[model samples]
Target: MAETSDQDSKTEEPTEKKVRDALEQGNIPVSREAPIFASMAALMVILTFLIGRGVQQITLTLKGLLDDPDGFPLGAPADALNLLTVVGLEALRFLTPLLVIFAVFGLAAQLLQNAPNLVLQRIMPDLSRISPLNGWKRLFGTQGLVEFAKSMFKLASVSAVVAFVLRSSEAKAFEAMYTDPVALPEMILSIAMRIVSAICIATIVLVAIDLAWARFHWRRELRMTKQEIKDEHKQAEGDPLIKARLRSLARDRSRQRMIASAARATLVIANPTHFAIALRYKREENAAPLVVAKGMDVIALKIREVAEQNRIPVIENKALARALYEAVQVDQVIPAEFFRPVAEIIYFLQSKQAPRPEKVQ
Candidate 1:
């Protein structure tokens, strides 16, 4: 009941990252019936194609030994060993193709459903797997009951299919008792082929249904609660407080750099306490005045202090400082609209540097 309540609370679909992590951990949606179908398919193939020739070869080898046992010195233990080796080799040769077919079919079945992923976690030892409580839960839980129902359905369906196949061949089977031993092999193979073919057909339908259900059930199980989704979001995007702190640190570093660069400016435009824009101008270095640093409040005071220490001129201009601070970026040439006012300031500074032509002598 508690588990069902927990499952019901997962209203949100699993995120891609959650699904990816599950895949990496080897938690994949695999229908158990798919591999059973593959085995049935392999068996059908063996019955249809390989079994006839394989059985023929083995029978011929066995017949050679059995038909003339008197010809061989069976009294000698070495002779018996030689005969055993031949029989074993022939048996192995016959079984090899069957084994290969089963292996290839099984691997293909798994590969078709999920791409191969190597997950060591799956192979790692875990106490939970052996815990009696967990085992009991697995055997009696809702999912366990569903699994039980599926197993029972498969067993009944396959049994019915096998019974029907056997019934259809009942006449042939009864005649096998009276039939010649030589013809018995072909008759038996034919009946076995029909049974396996019917089983394969039956399992193909089950495989389709089970494959879809397995994936759907897997996704349903992975669904996230609202709080889990929010927690995952926070983890991915980062904590709000930490992000704000980072932004604050970035602004502080920027202010420090701005104050440091202000020492290179030729003149500092100030609105007393609120705004300061430091301009660097050189006829040979730039086409127009460059605002190398600008700041407000505490940073504005820092820029002014740096300007004072560097002996750079601090010109008070309430309107121009406010306008330039709004319009200009640090390290960029001031725009055209403010050219006249700023140019007049440059002119005044140049006038101060103009050689007093001469005290009129």
Candidate 2:
């Protein structure tokens, strides 16, 4: 077990990319407490605000039924159907608000519990879910044990709150048993309300703690190993070896273009065997001499060979060659400071006067 954990286990937090990908697959932190809390809260709302109205409506309905036994619209099929529709509409009008509010509360709780993410992957079937071994593990594993413990805790807490409420109101309840029928309902309702309110308040506290625990557990579950992080990074950026090869190919192609451009240069400035820069000036095209080709080492030698084949003059100027190679790029005009020196080289080549060529070292 320890060796297995050491292989690809994670101790670090999940990266943002990992979290986002998980979300896309419908993996998100969700607490069971959210649904329970929403249900309890909705129940509380109904008990506090709608219960009296519901009781009054029921009372009216019963009274209406009893008040005219003969006139009750069950005389014929048409009359009965009409009466049922009227009663159904009336009930729906009163009850729809409560139902809608309950639904809203539950939906709001879920939205607040998890970032809103919709993914079709969640509905995809998984064979593992139906496997007997997986079922057994779900029922007997650590998560199962925790759930059992939580259920027991909730049951005990609610039972205790109910017992406390009843015990506190025991005397009133006993007295109400012998009192007038009209006041008995009020007394019973009072005790029931107290019990429900206490239970809801207690459960709210439990739900809050459960929600925090669920979020922490989910984050831990999503943690990634070092290898996983590295793989994800590579997938996002690209493979390093492939990228290096591509760069080498690009540089070689660029070098070929530069060497070819050297054939049209007015002259080649050589830094012995270390560097070479080919200068080209077209009075109609450029305001200053342009470094048509530039290269180092073997590429410098190729640039010189190209110049020799084109009968372009080769001058030895170590400083100017190095400066041009370092400061200017192929096809770019020389800087203002190097203008006079490069212009003299261009002028010497254009004059058709063969200056003494520097010997190849």
Candidate 3:
């Protein structure tokens, strides 16, 4: 049983149908590293654009508080609350742009990883998700190990990048420290930006590796078993027995309609057994003769019955009947190339008494 189970799960590549079904179910592979990379990159951009203004604003606020200590409320609780509110508002204003930037990057990262698709199933709850076995599998299985390894690698890589940046700039940073105090803030900001740039570059490399792994892993997970492929094929093509029955029913209805249409035909040209084509012509209504009905074998026999019952002429001309049956469809004019032959037959029928019905071959 165990071997059988393994065999059933042996498929290593997903079919296109499986991938489409998985997408409909909102089961897509996601890389945790993608969001981390986007956030870090956004931070690098934000810092590059706003760090100098942010630092200068905060420094001014601090200096104002220090220089005017008496301006701050001291004892009264209401006054202290007012003072706190002002400071809180200032901090909120400073952080709001960063928060917005983070949110935009997060959204962009998710959309990049999985292009926009409406998946109603994703919002629906599944009891299977709460099962203890599934939870345990997620916590302790290969996925858990992979996640842990990724986290450790990211942490180590970022730490290594920061250390390298700091080490390389140690001389410049030390020199800045000994320079004018008035220039210290700008110098510090420059060093911080350099470190952020290095970290962003490193995170980008991790994101690329994770994206490739995620796609490969997703494809493997969506693979179908041999039985699943068979089932999907059956679903797409329909059950052969059921399809055959439907086709038989359709043919029966079509044959019945052909017989009814023969009621208005001028004559039926038949091959004596296998082929029958009913022709109609009206000089006032149409310029050419129309093939109103056609059939083969058993249907040809029925067409003969209908033609005789309606007093429609039945001419047995094997070659003409076969050609008309092969080339012309019900309600269609016989092609111009065969018009002369059909016209001659019609002229003969008009000039003579309608022939008695003959047995169909």
Predictions in order: lDDT: 0.89, 0.83, 0.83
Among residues 3 or more apart in sequence or in different chains, the pairs in candidate 2 whose N, CA or C atoms overlap within 3 Å are none
- TM-score of candidate 1 relative to the true fold: 0.91
**Which candidate, 1 or 3, has the higher lDDT?**
1
Q: After superposition, which runs of candidate 2 have C-alpha atoms over 4 Å from their true positions?
A: 2-8, 73-75, 355-361
Model 3 misses residue 125 by how many Å?
3.2
lDDT tens digits, residue span 138-201, model 2 = 8887678978888998999999999999899989978986789978766767777888789889
Candidate 1 per-residue C-alpha lDDT over 1-361 given as tens digits, one digit per residue, 9 for 90 to 100: 7978998999899999999989989999999989999999999999899999998899788888789887667788998998788888999999999999999999999999999999999999999999999999999986688789889888998899889988988898899898898998888888888888888888888888889989999999899999998889889999889999999999989888888999999888898899999999999999899989999988899998998888787888888889999999988999999889889887776778633211110
Candidate 2: deviation at residue 293, Å?
Answer: 1.0
Relative to the true structure, candidate 3 reaches a TM of 0.74
- List ranges where model 3 is wrong by over 4 Å: 1-17, 46-49, 117-120, 162-195, 263-297, 307-361
lDDT of 3 by residue, 1-361 (tens): 6845674695856778888888878899898898988888888878888767876787788789889988996789988898788788878878888899999999999998888888878878899899999988787776778778888888998899889988988898789867998898777777788888888888888888888888887886677778788778889999888999999999888878888998899888999889988888999978999888899998898888898898888888888888888899888899998899888877776666556643333
Give the Cα error of residue 328 in candidate 1, in Å.
1.0
Better of 2 and 3 by TM-score: 2
Q: Superposing all C-alpha atoms, what RMSD in Å does each candidate have to the true structure? A: 4.0, 2.7, 4.7
How many steric overlaps are in each model, in order?
0, 0, 2
